[model samples]
Target: MSESAPTRPLLNLDALFDNPVFAGGFGLASLGAVLAFARRGAISTVGLIRRRMLVNVEISRQDPSYPWILAWLSQPREQTSFLARRLTRINKLSVTTTTSVTANGPTRASFFLQPGYGRHVIKYKHAYIVVSREKQATAKTNTGEPHETVELTTLYAHRHIFEDVFTEARALALQAHEGKTVVYSVRNFDWVPLGEPRRKRPLGSVILDEGVKERIVDDAKDFLARRQWYVDRGIPYRRGYLLYGPPGSGKSSFIQALAGELDFSVAMVNLSEIGVTDDKLAFLLTKLPERTILLLEDADSAFINRRKREADGYSGGTVTFSGLLNALDGLSAGEERIAFLTTNHIELLDPALIRPGRVDLMVHIGGATRYQAAQMWDRFYGDVDVDGAYRERFLKRLDELELFGEAKEGQPVTRTSTAAIQGLFLFNKNDMDGAISMAEGLIPPKLEAEQ
Candidate 1:
């Protein structure tokens, strides 16, 4: 190769500047200074100016405060903004488990979940307070005059470390007996899930016998007709139904079937499991989605027993009466929400709760009858074509089984079941045919007697 002038490797300035030995000595000192400044909440002069300008811009967007600023600055007078004055009073009061501070003064304290922001700081003559976006704080009246503690951290860290603590604190606050005028808005009753369940069983997947399906379709048709009528008249469209039957008689299944038939979502609430006050109950109701089927399962017992106990005997006696009234027909019970109440004993329900307007329909799902049993047998055996003698024998027995009702005038004779015999036979693949035949045999004699 020709002897060429050696080329420098791009002057190597970056390599020289990035020497680990030099970096270790200089970077540590610089980092320590920055940390000290941050701890003291001291911003550089240039950064302070920039922040002031940004805050002023935010203020100007709200109103032309220039005139007031100039007046106050020129006169050297102290004046507090409305927000500042309000926050000032909020900072003074100590809250205990049973007390709450009003917006008017620190004397009134109420328990509230600290939002995404960190604990509130009272400063600047109590006229200015800082609420950080990092942490959250809540206050409650201490029963033993205990002082409140303010937590400080970023929202991410706080949520990770103190979520359970916050939850328990919130629960205690909700349970505390504070004598205050509770104002429950109708919107509060509406409830939406914070996060959807990772695994959800679809309502449509519920298995129902043909007889139940027919009943659901019939009820849906009737409901739709009435709903459409109301819509035509420009009235608030609302319907309430009470489903009362023995447990495991498919009361829940029937409701699910109706929901599937109507193409509506079922919002189920176990009144017994809802551990909240009347105000919270109203909040949940108000929050319910429109066009939804609000199902209160076991509502009779839930209201009379479970809820009553939670209300300290006030619920069943008087408080629950008032609370239920508000829950059912209050201003929040908007026009489009449909309600269904299911109970094993309708007798336990208060008349006011199930009155004409509140519960428009009372459906009685009694024990399965023989007619229902025959239909279930038919459903199990319908597809199989037996020999002529067997078919004739089956028909005769079906008629006598006492499960078939007279077809309504001008309507097709649809086989319907009065019992859950299908469920009984669904898993018995080996005995299904024989069991069905036996059920048919019971029917023929009843048909002969009726004829």
Candidate 2:
């Protein structure tokens, strides 16, 4: 047999290269080895370590750093990175435009970047920022099904570079949210993420007594600035505010404005929601963002007749009064959290829940006052370049309603709510006289016939 043709090896080298998967994997491994050999010296050098940070979308309800990293990577002026090419495509793609209201108007639009791997350079900071998406397998479900989740992985040149990158990224996110106010409400008992922000009355636009505004804002600033003070005294760096007011007052509006003013995100919690157990509440409170303002609206409804529950020997509710108290006391709360408990009926709350340490500040948000009415009117119509005659006509009608005269300093005031006024304005948009007339008609008759 011609000595079996000299018995060439059974494995064919050419055939191995013909198989794409095998060839590709072999090529990658060879390249990795070569790189490792070439960079041996550089790897030995001190102070050149590559560091990585992971940001997840599920853990603690989507780490904020992930969005911050995206914002940093999407910088339009970054020319020397892979992200530049993708960003250019992103800008060119005809995507849906999301409009949000701001102090300026609803003209501002936000576009979310598509998720992918991108290389970016932080010029001033002298670092390479590489972002990648990582898919992980989650625990099996009750049906014995496997699930996959995606998270963001951010790699930087060094640990120190990560610090600078995060600082700048956070600033960028805050800038993007400027002049816009977001409202967050509890979802799934464990999620306190933000909802779509509506055009809200700014801090300056919402009318509260000058003293009240000053006290709340100044106190918040002081509290934020006093973190070290609290640590020094071994006190938990937490504070609470109680906003008790009738429905439609500036309670929620003021909170929204304060969130915008402070550049702090809001995370609202509703205690009465299903599945809100003590442990879940604690987890939610402790996992809130550091600079978040937690709003627990309708506290009375959440903890109705706590005293009665205790006296009647009943131990049932989605959340017990003790659980709420513990959550508010910062037992497992975030280090730098401020909470607001709002109610229309404060007396229905258990005294133990709103005691001195639990509620540091109590603010009563009554109906809108004269200054508020005038401010709302001016804010709504002052900017219009409408006919001077029509403007005067609207003002005369507004004055005729005398909504401004309902409240006076040091006197009991019966007034309409800012929400009621805003509703009237919305229904009669661009018709100033109609808004004023409808606003006047909103006051209910004093005596109602028995139903």
Candidate 3:
């Protein structure tokens, strides 16, 4: 033990530092740590500067401005292309199809390719705007469609620039909707476009009973014009109309045409939709877009007997009768909303749902009448039927077939619907004699149903 202690002196700490291998390793480790710390500090400083100097505008998918900005950014112009290149090498595009889908897949039609959720950069007139799209917590919707938003950041913090951007974006969006009617439906407690904007249907094309269309249109115009009257009277600035008649009696068609006539968009509501609860209905009604028409088709289906529905093995919806009534004019019924309810069987509807306030006007859009038929015929031939030769023969054929059904009382109501007559005309297209000849062959649909 004595010999071993003598041989091994003390380990010198100074010598260890002086050794080449140990010293070199220590120097490298120290340098690496310092560099890392310096880099991290630089990054933090840059982030802080950005936070202080830059401004950002957040556009939510729920806002109408979201689509407007999207449309603006999706433009295939020099700026968009340049931005696409400088932002990222990855080109993520979303396909918007106006084409119809089939079992074979999607058919070919005009479609727009918009940038997907990603970072984009655009050089504006005097500023560099950065657009960041994200599908974060807001992506979830009841319809399962993605809900996204864009954050527009720029070095310039002026409000005018953002306003200008939105102004231009709105103009672009309106251009897209010009001469068309955009229909909307509810999803995730918000209204969303159902499909592509449809070409505006001419009001003249819709054939209704004498003065029916005029009366409804006049009432709508008056309601729109008299907003201040309701306000002064301390009444809800809302109007409701009920169109009740047989199926294919031009209820939906007239509604669409009326929307075109009023230059308003259509927000179609289905009370019996799977997840449309009473609360949802009230919220939707309360938050309808300005200059929008809310239409409820098959309104009687939901108001009909629930037990009867269950007995028929048809599980309806969550909207109850009382809930619907309250949604119509309750505390939160909302003002400035024009609601249109259509039903094939009005008798099935509860009387409370169509009282004075709820359904201010109940227009009976009955089956095809002589006046309606004549107007439709004149529309097809236009001024070419000036001699009235074809028109007279058509009316004679209608009488012989007993299509009007206004004859003897015991006969089944054979008044053919405008839709049925239109179908026949479409089948014969511009051939008056041909349509008259075919009318005598097939039994009218209403007659068959009643018989």
TM-score of each: 0.44, 0.64, 0.80
Select the stronger candidate by lDDT from 1 and 2. 2
C-alpha displacement of 125 in model 2, angstroms?
9.4
* Clashes by residue pair, model 3: none
- The sequence of per-residue lDDT tens digits that candidate 2 reaches over residues 20-88 is 999999999999999998788676553244322422222111455765665565665545667544533
Cα lDDT, model 3, residue 177: 88
**What's the lDDT for residue 56 in model 2?**
22
Q: Candidate 3, TM-score vs. the true structure?
A: 0.80
Model 2: which ten-residue window has the lowest total lDDT?
A: 52-61
Best candidate per TM-score, number? 3
* lDDT values for all models: 0.50, 0.65, 0.80
Model 1: residue 159 alpha-carbon error in angstroms = 32
Model 1 accuracy (lDDT, Cα): 0.50
lDDT of 3 by residue, 1-451 (tens): 3555456658988999999999999999999999999999999999899888888999988786887888888876454566555753427778777765555896758778777888877765667777888887645545676768899998756545888899999999889989999899887688878877888999998999888999999999999999999999998899999998888889999999999999899998877666776667888877788788989877776675253325654434566676677777897678898899988888889888888899999998878887887888888875777888898888888887777765344323546778878888889786777888887544665556776
Clashes of 2: 0
Once fitted onto the true fold, the runs of candidate 1 whose alpha carbons sit more than 4 angstroms away are: 1-235, 274-277, 302-319, 385-420, 436-451
Clashes of 1: 49
- RMSD in angstroms, candidate 3? 6.3
